[model samples]
Target: MSDSQKPASDPRYPDIRHVAEARRLRSQGALIIDALGGIILCPLDTSRADLRILDSATADGHLLTLIRKQLAHPESAELIGTDIADYPPLDLPENITLEKQDILKPWPEKWEAHFDFVHQRTGLAVTGGMERAVETVRRFIELVKPGGWIQLVDGTLIDHKIAEDDKAWVKLFKVLSQCVTLVGLDTSLGVSTAEILKRAGEGLVRNIGEKQGVSPLGKGASSKELEELGYVELKGMHSGFVTMLKGMPEDKRPTALEQVEGLLPEVLREAQAGECEMRWYAAWGQKI
Candidate 1:
């Protein structure tokens, strides 16, 4: 097929197709929120009845629903969730609206400075590079009113640490990195997000703060509960790696897939030994 006529492929991770993937995304989102200590991390009072909040890349409206429940007056607050594709859950409250929005592009004029708080999780890297990420953050900042806040969350792939050198683990990571890069997903954006936000909102935002944490992978976790959670994340990420591998150019696809398939056993063994861990970053700032 001609390149122009080829079907478009989504570069985003955690393909939301089956019940399992959906559940995984929900669970992952909730865990990150819990680790960060709450749904709304900014200094703003979430209990305020008139607050306006936006959750970008809000698949299935799960986070929005949670935020709605926490509000002092759910009916009075305005909560909107936007994604490039609509997968909204059923029976949503009237005050919560889920609409299809391409966050990488310009939003409607009416949305400018319309929200009291703007949030995005694991979304910006889809822009493919730092420049587009910055552009997207600027738009996010624009969506907030004076003194409103914008927050972001994503993995800092670069900050990951291993207890010992494992050739198989390193090889698999290199292959996965190639796949994400080819798919236009910058997995390292997590650490850079805070700096990007600062650059994106230089004169417009203040009181910027960032937090980081490591989530152990597989059975190497500190506790049974964490071990299970880490396994879930690892599994979901593996699925994404395979999905990206499939999207590679035909000439390069076979070799890369073969390499990843061959390395899985060793990689899993290393993770099970608790030698693998991943890091994430949460950054938030308020508009001046």
Candidate 2:
């Protein structure tokens, strides 16, 4: 359910196997919900009749599933998940539907002001860059009804709390951010979440809210749940790093690959022995 309208061959869109990515998305979704303390923020009234929600970039529809379980009146809600691809888990309740959507493009006119809530997360991989991010948020605003809510979440690479001495772990993340930039995506997506929401909504939304949360990794993990979440995040990032390697020039690719590979063990050790955290930001606004 990642958001990439680009062709599957696009280097920016890592070719992770569906099974692996699905696992990552599920874990990430759980982590986000845990961080936020709920699936729907923005002061939603979930019991409203015919409530509607859209999860953009809804890879594997994991988030929608979570919503379904948590909603006060799940059966009354119109739950929709959209992504570049159309594969939805068969177990999704009848209330939930998955569709193929390229959020970078204009959406259907019928969808304008249609949902009660719109959600997007981890979209820097395909949102192009900072400018495109604003556009994407604007699109999300257009999809919700008047007085409805739109929420955005993303990882703030390098905007995290790590021990000053954890140089190896820090270096690994720096390289990862560089790889994302090399692939033409914005590494600053996370920190820019609030700004993007504000810029995009302009006069269209009100009461914009923003917050940041940490997903602990390795030994910095405060609980077993967070420890596992860290590992899941690390695995997903490693896969993305390898995929980005293919886009590099022949001369640089090998060295970059070796460097990442060599860093894994030491980084893993550091993570398990000490504290590491992935910082994330979420912003939301109610459409006026």
Error of 1 at 161 (Å): 15
Report how far off residue 257 is in candidate 2 (Å). 1.0
TM for every model, in the order presented, reads 0.84, 0.88
**Weakest 10 consecutive residues, lDDT, candidate 1?**
1-10
What is the RMSD of candidate 2? 3.7
Alpha-carbon RMSD of each model:
4.4, 3.7
Query: For residues 1-288, could you state the per-residue lDDT of candidate 2 as single tens digits?
Result: 453322255555555535666777787777776676666777877767788899998887878887777678888889989887544255788889888788788998989999999998888557767788788888889899998999988886662434556576676787676666666766677788899899999999999998887766756665787678777877777766766676577675533677676776776776687656677788899999
Enumerate residue pairs that collide in model 2: 1-58, 1-59, 219-271, 220-274, 220-275
Candidate 2 lands at a TM-score of: 0.88
Question: Which of the numbered candidates is closest to the native, going by highest lDDT?
Answer: 2
Q: Which stretches in model 2 have alpha-carbon errors above 4 Å? A: 1-7, 85-90, 159-166, 252-255
Per-residue lDDT value at 240 in model 2 = 63
- Candidate 1 similarity to native, TM-score: 0.84
